[model samples]
Target chain A: MRKPPYPTVLKPYGQALLDLAKEREEIVCLSGDLTRQCEIDLFRDALPERFINVGMAEANMMGIAGAMARQGLIPFVHTFGVFATRRPFDQIVNAIAYPSLPVRIVGFMPGVSSPGGPSHQAIEDVAIMRALPNMTVIDVADAVEIRKVVPQIVDLPGPVYLRLKRGEIPVIFDDDHEFFLDRAQVLESGEDVAVIANGMMLSSALLAAEALRGAGISVAVVNAPVVKPFDTRTVEAVARGVRAVVTAENHTIVGGLGTAVAETLAEAGLGRPLRRVGLKDTFAEGAKTAPHLFKKYGLSTQDIIDAAWNALGRTDSAPTAAPTPAETGEYAPV
Target chain B: MPSSTTTSEVSISRFADTIRLRAVMMVAPQGFGYLGQALSSAEIFAGLYTHAYRPGHDRLVCSPGHYIIGAYAAGVEIGLLPEEALLTYGQDDSDLEAIGTETSPAVDLTCGSLSQGLSGGVGLSLADRIKGEAGRRVFVLASDGELEEGQTWEAAMFAAHQGLGALTVLLDANDSQVDGPVSEITTVEPIAGKWEAFGWHAVDVDGHDPEQLVRALDETGSDPRPSIIIARTSTRQGLACLPEDADGHFIKLPPDLAEAAVQELESRLA
Candidate 1:
């Protein structure tokens, strides 16, 4: 994993997809009038015949992708997180999941990452997607995972709901770090508090783990990219060694990464004092910058720190707020 | 391209009767099912399976789950679906759901979710076009009530936008829904004009007439624009022995009524 003030990569997802599509003929990219925003513009320009601009009709777009998959083409459908999941959920369930097709629903700008407010924020995407039987819900942490994820989930048996961050993505993990659909990246192995995270909040968890270590509290950090089909054995092993657990996500705590961790631990006969750091079951407002919403929604590095402190029964003042991790040219990771 | 397994000897009229007979048998065992769908769409399905659909080449998506019963019957009338499978219709541990699910055979994809099938058909058409498979066509069997759904118009707009010439919609305009007359529930009339406005080649026809249905089916994939055959039908189109109080939407079949209905359907061959 990379340190703070990490380098950022622009359009990593779009570029990786384009490169993969060149070799994989079955990779068909779909856009819902947000091609540039979701970063599938590269795919459109590179492979005109394979890329489809399905206008603003998300429901039809989902069905179309499902049908395309039915004919042996792996469709990577793109749109904002909300439009991709909430708008066309039934179509995804009926046309894709129920049929167990190999269509990948690429939802960008998950949670409060979208500056478009509640209407555009997909705070509940993971929860809804995780409920579906055959769906593989994923939330990658950085550009490294983004690049590695595209090639991995191409033919993953059934439909996949991939939650991605739009625009310039941060480089959290270095080139040597590997991403797997069925494994969690154990970034640190300290035993006091276990911090589990996915999507944009993963950077926050990593940063908070650093600060917690400075405060002399040992913390175990795990990056849970694939929320559904969660790496339960890894999580159980990590959580079992820790006194308390903290789950941070760029989504609501209700049914997202936090809930996944909670359910996994509870079912395994392991009960730890768990604190969830996320949206707290509330809608977010429109913002000028993504960090404004992230900070206001209690999804910053400090939030993870506080949650870990609370879980560990450490009542002292939360660690000092750290500098905003990414600069203007980069996308917000927390 | 035709299904290699197709037995083309069966006449369209006989095929339609076969659909009706098989559907009645499937629903009668349960004492209740979407019998109205089979009655209304038997002719429409019979015409398509015999004239337009090529099992291995062409794609047929049944959009309305309830409408699938009729298509299932048509599948049995031919040798495509196993003969004895109809006996387990609507029973537990049976894949033959009363309202066809994605697991059901014969149709490609699902009809379980109303108003989504047309969009799927458009996608299939686009895939065939992308693969340069010019001979492959896609057909969607839909119900009139689905016109009320916003997704239907959304799919319609996408199909037209793509200029999916190989796509066709066999719209069953039975004008009856579970909530009574569809006209009372929603104004779906001027259906042809709506399709035309959506940039499709719309053809209105007597759904039960074999000749009209066959002609409409023949016009599919003839141009850059998609086509929709608005088939006007009645839920009680063919049977002569239904009692005066029989509800066409969902008939409750008593032993006596089922026997009478079966005898009437069988005697029609005479």
Candidate 2:
């Protein structure tokens, strides 16, 4: 695979967290045996007094984080996204989110970040967290943004669910870029079409934009890292000017960025031709390679390009026909 | 003995009675609650708040959150909450939420899922230890039914291995659960022995006796290991109007029997 236009930057979000732990004594970290994968080893080493390993118990880790928060300690509970979401969603909802505690939930190995196959991929985490009340859902696009956003989330006085990628993710944002918790950032501006993306899909969206640019279709890329409390204003404004809107996410199409953008547009009465490029309604089979899995789930760069073209009502073939409700089902309403 | 000491002891007993009365009032609104558990556990709750527990400092998590009436009663007795809050028990727009305890200044954790409280309690104890606040204790109240949860065992192992001596678990071995008797569902017989095997300093005692409960709590300090007090209690100790076999898990007193049960409790108190 060819590298994108951005330089390969080794941005360490977890190391920055370790540095923050030096001054903030109230910051306690908990891991469920994912220390190496989560890159929180430095924090564990530096602050042995505050770091706790709850074995392989994710549910207990959540409960521990909640109780620690109650005692005026800020706990960052780290684990894989699947374990954090499916294994302990009830604890997250009742113990952490319901009480609005200052517990930072770091869901590592999000969206194919783990090569250990389907069981490790966290494609549905956003859907689970966004449905709950008082939960701030965030998907960091790259390491630079993750480091910038981590400290800000600690300061915010509520439960924060931060999705982090494992290992060295290519840096998409510049160091000088000012990132906010709830605000959307427009990386590139154009009037032809708007491409909304988050997480690893942000890089794909940017790549798809370049591919579209070569083919005479101007596209704008907006990085919406925060899904819950989404930037509806930005979505509405951009949707009005663009010919069609395409949403890209490394999550399932059901309740991730695609659903969030569609909901916003529908609510604002600006519904238009929109295409969502994400995982289909299915679990990862755990047999295929990561690249094959991405291709099969329609999360590749080419998939976004095809989706953008489809949204613009463009057909490469000779046959042109009217869309039918019977054929399209729910897509007809959109 | 000095007269002042005698007066203080009487006041403490009165405080325990106030907790029982507040719990009884809260249950009256719903027509019923875990009244047996509340009544049996009132004295222990009173002692914790009045003597053992340092309010606004230490942490206490109720594992079997269904026994919210007892916790509310303890809060009311200690003036942490008002007695009028009991009027909203099981009512709409009431802070007294059914099943799950609502988040309030008086409540430490919103515990409804069984076995979560012990894990949460371990977290608090670890936090206190990290802060070097060794005097602060983390108390968790677990019901007999809660032992069925695997997470409780995980927390038990965790607390014991960490040597969290400041963490204390009080088990209300009422021998009752939702389906039927705890033994029928899953026998937790020899609970004290099981806890001892798990590396805790286990103490089995009559849950209803306030003096025994206090003594057991005092002994916990002497042991370096985390403590578990297996409180032997009855499912329906105070309200004898109901049949002994009547399941106290979710008591549904008919309208006609409600007045009789209340009258019986009043006569017992008198």
Model number with the top DockQ: 1
lDDT of 2: 0.78
Model 1 Cα lDDT, one tens digit per residue, B1-270: 333323432477778877788878888877877888888898888888888888888999999988778777888766778888888888998888888886687777666778988998988999998888887888999989899999999989888988888899999998888778899988998999999999999999999877778778887658668999999998887787776556667877777777887888888855
Extract clashing residue pairs from model 1: none
Give candidate 1 misplaced runs (Cα > 4 Å): A324-327, A330-334, B1-10
* Stretches > 4 Å off in candidate 2: A1-11, A286-288, A317-334, B1-21, B104-107, B254-256
lDDT per residue for candidate 2 within A284-315, as digits (tens), equals 66544465667677887788888888888888
TM, every model: 0.96, 0.91
Q: Give Cα distance to truth, residue A15, candidate 1, Å.
A: 0.5
Question: What DockQ, between 0 and 1, does each candidate earn?
Answer: 0.80, 0.71
The candidate 2 chain B region of ten consecutive residues with least summed lDDT is B1-10
Overall local distance difference test of candidate 1 = 0.87
After aligning candidate 1 to the native by TM-score, how far in Å is the CA of B173 from where it should be? 0.6
